[model samples]
Target: MRVPRRRRDAVEVNLTPLIDVVFLLLIFFMVSTTFETRQALELELPESVSGVAQVSSPVTVVVTAEGDYRLGQRALSADELASRLSDAAPQAREAGLVIEADGRAPHAAVVRVLDRAGALNIRRVRIATAEATHTEAERP
Candidate 1:
């Protein structure tokens, strides 16, 4: 008598659970991530008819209407401002200094900052200003 041979079944892999696990991992990473935000000072720059575009990123010094001085959003005294400018002189010599003074700020304050920048031998100095609009011209 001849013995009957047993037939073998073809093996198959199920991918539904593998795809579900991958999607869960993606969602877990997306929900656990944190984003960083930068701090900035609120300012209203003076307007001018001949305002020019800035080419390089300069060290920004902000003078408020209340006569307060800020460098990169940190408040500092006149002496501190001078020291900071001197420390940054090498980089500023090429990148320049930008004075972002408020419109309501006193002229003397702006001039004082300019004088400080000059003392540091920073020749490339610019006063930040917005372009004058037709409405602004009509108002005055």
Candidate 2:
């Protein structure tokens, strides 16, 4: 009597389900993510009892406590500041300018930024300020 033998096929893995799960995880992470903008300069803005919320984007000029000037994230000298402002005249004029001066920043430093803006004829200028968190009794 002769016995018959059966051949076995090659073993294989189905990766479709694995790939689908990976894609699902990727989409979940993307949907759960949030985006925000951070300031380049760390500043303690002066308190204001009448501070208004800003609605539009504007060209920002930062004046540090040490009287240093920053146009965007780049440190600029007085001469450089003037040049840059002039170079972006049209945009600056259209978008307007916002000065974010530190609470302890020198008055002259802020004035210098203002002078430049005036020279460039930028009409809409606003100083960034934090809302006051004090009562009448708290005021000196």
Candidate 3:
């Protein structure tokens, strides 16, 4: 008696089409995307356990524990800070403002700086602080 011939079953998990689609997508994104640059002006940014990625084009106002105010690295008085914020409002790229103060700085001082910044229609503000000085702290 002749035995019946068996047919091979079809393979189900086809990755070839998926791989081609993925590769094409990668190539398209690589060709069309522009990379953002890392700025060069350096300062020791305070570390945080829950800090988010720093935003681009922030107007940084720093206050020392002794009550000195700085715009980036340049110091500014209360009136000067207000004037600068008012002047720069028209040209600022971001509506967000970042004010970093030393640990010992008083809340009132921080409030004062923030109030003036608010007058210029700066809506978003954040306070920056270092991670609680834990030993063996690692960079995230």
Query: Of the candidates shown, which would achieve the greatest lDDT relative to the real structure?
Result: 2
Error of 3 at 112 (Å): 0.6
RMSD of 2: 4.1
Residue range with the least summed lDDT across 10 consecutive positions in model 2: 33-42
Model 1 Cα lDDT, one tens digit per residue, 68-139: 788765788877888877877887778888888999888888888899888888898988888877565498
- In angstroms, give how far residue 93 of model 2 lies from its true place: 1.2
lDDT of 2 by residue, 30-120 (tens): 9997654435568999998888899654478888999988876678888899998788667878888889899999999999999989998
- lDDT score, candidate 3: 0.71
Model 3 Cα shift for residue 137 (angstroms): 16
- What's every prediction's RMSD, in angstroms? 5.8, 4.1, 12.0
Candidate 3 wrong stretches, greater than 4 Å: 1-49, 91-95, 133-140
**lDDT of predicted model 2:** 0.85
Candidate 1: segments with Cα more than 4 A from true spot:
1-40, 135-137
In terms of TM-score, how similar is model 3 to the real structure? 0.54
Residue-level error in angstroms, candidate 2, position 11: 12
